[model samples]
Target chain A: MSVKNEKKFNVVYGEAVGAVAAHSFGEPSTQMVLRTFHSAGIASSVVTGLPRILELVDARKKQQSPIMTIRLEKSYAKNYEKAKQVKAQFEEVLVKSLLESFTEDLKNVTMLLEFSKEKLAQSDLTLKFISGKLQAKFESIETEQEGNKLKIKYKSKKEMKSARTMFVNMRNFAIKGLQGIKKATVQQDDDGEFYIVTSGSNMAGALEVDGVDKEHLYSNDMFDVLKVYGIEAARNMIANELKKTMDEENVSVGFRHIGLLADAMTYGGSIKSAGRHGIAGNKASVFARASYEETVKHFVNASVFGERDPLKGVSENILIGKQINVGTGRIKLAIKKEDLKKVDAEK
Target chain B: MVVHEVLSESEAKKVSAEYNTPIDKFPKILQSDPQVIKIGAKPRQLIKIHREDPTGKYSAYRYVVESV
Candidate 1:
């Protein structure tokens, strides 16, 4: 490379590119209203704009909505019936949805359950299975399937109050599908390929579903991705999700800036927010820490811990009115008369 | 053993001295980068990436400092 090219590509010393990146992202973001829009027909249709980006950068533990997209295998994706079967497996079925009505007796509780011949056969659910599941929890329970209605009688020594609570508990018991996932539906994408979209994220459990395409599965939650695919995948997810949200809002920010932010968030091998509780609050320089937030707290901690600030960074140097160690400030020149004489002699 | 190893304190110091660049200013690689994990590289360690052109006649060298 020529000296001219080197000068062209070289970042000016003390330029504070961090501030430049911040301005690039923040200026356009001000024009965007902090709102989320809904898109119809899309399974993962939540379009949270700037607020979502803030949450990601801050590395908030809880998000507004956590969703997962589970793509099925090639064969299953072509068949509507196969996709429905997979979706059913992801549904969280409660015992309450199965029961019609219940009455409490002195020593036994009697319950009536509505049955659908076609639906039961489709879900592979039988009265025998339900009875066995109930019996597993309650010792003395009997079931009688009469036509379309099934009656359950529970004989336990517990009192009426506790029996009623037990009855409520039994009603909420899961008969099928994975827990945590409230709803799942098979939706066709732009390519006409079918995949399951879930309301709640349960990556590990959803991956266990038969015919699920492990490689293509995606979740909105960064931690869930980290738990299943390790840190690299999570970092990529952060960048991609952030970019998608930004693009939806019609705001333009360079991908490299977002990549840099993601890299900062996960540089420690663990994901951290750029908030007070994470990186900003834990700066090495005392002035830098005090400048961000909770000024007194940071000062008090530094004082009590006998911390010393070297004042090497841009933030601390700017705070204390010192030249920051960047750009031209990074270079130190010391020329002696003897050295000048030597140079003159060499010439 | 992992192919990527975190450079020891002395090794990191040596690399910085050789390049005559501050460690912080070195080209960055994330701790979550797959190649960094495969070699078990950590923050502040210098990583050397060697690649060859598809034609097999050209080669390239790049260095990255792992950061979190």
Candidate 2:
């Protein structure tokens, strides 16, 4: 009895689950706005809506703003000063912001860089550090520091125009934080626990942070998650992101539907979108391929390759005006009364 | 060892044959599902699950399914 009850919950015969899943996700998505404004708060303010869903389904590698939430060791997390220090380390201090004024001496072909005592202290930088990083980055660069002021002179005789660009580049140089991470902030939760949140993602580098809790660190970038935690974790992240996005829109969707979408996208051992460049574009059935997008291209390609459509899928069957093999259409019956009479005669 | 075991290629074929339908038509479990991973099941591979019936009248019950 239990076995029979359990079997009843299974997918019905000939159910076109793929089409159903698509519709289940699609209808609700139409009500969703093109882009939802970022809600300001401690939580991830990443945009949610159709654009985000499209990006996730496409399995894009780079997101608009890749943010990382770095959980700290309990000892550091409990202390406010320690959390500040950790956060400070992740905050990027650009060289340009430190300068009080920039002047280029065209006659001497020398770029003058000056800094105030308070600005240097606020930036947590010194003349020596700035000069050293600059010298390392450029060839034949000379630096002279007199107190808080630093003068940069290029050894090259030509290219006065390139001097301004060089000065701009040097001014925007990052003096603190890991490369690619633009900003970092310290946030306190309801329990008064503090953690570092970053504007850009660099999981591998974040793991190296002294007080970072490696296990608890997470980033919004799916590709980074895939790179750091294998395909399984990446698939879960995609599914969860999809659900979360929809939930924020006050839309309800079955997890199984989103899970199926994720599984289909990741079944090939990697993430692929449901778009033309990904899973749907690579279908084996010629009719199925033709039904998606670029009907002529698919038809031409199939003809060139002599490809055959077995009409196994719902799309192709529907195109051919056949009963789609789903629900009742999936079932066929064959009965012969003459065979029963023959069996009775044999008996 | 995993709590469930994934069916081998031949076993998956047999399970599909018993269902009298294509593998895709069956209920799905993600390849990343914890049990599927524990059993080292890949996509399209079937997993055999054994669970103890809560009623105790039927102590042993099993189900086989393909991983998505």
B1-68 per-residue lDDT for model 1 (tens digits) = 11233566677777778767766665455666666666776566666533221112221112344444
Q: Each model's number of backbone clashes?
A: 7, 3
Query: What's model 1's lDDT at A36?
Result: 38
Off-target runs (Cα >4 Å) in candidate 1 are: A1-15, A34-47, A94-175, A337-347, B1-68
Model 1 TM-score (2 dp): 0.66
Pairs that collide in candidate 2 are A14-A326, A14-A327, A96-A171
lDDT (Cα, tens digit) per residue for candidate 1, span A1-347: 44444445545656767777778877777777533333334454453776688878887777777889998999999899999988988887776666555554545556677766666676678878877877786677677877767677665455667667767777777778776678888899899999888987889888788899987899988888776665556767888898888888788787656766776776655688888888787679889989998899889998999999888788888898987787677878899999999999999
Error of 2 at A181 (Å): 1.6
By summed lDDT, which 10 consecutive residues of candidate 2 chain B come out lowest?
B53-62
Name the best candidate (by TM-score): 1
Per lDDT, the best of the predicted structures is 2
Q: TM-score of predicted model 2?
A: 0.65
> Which ten contiguous residues of candidate 1 chain A have the minimum total lDDT?
A34-43
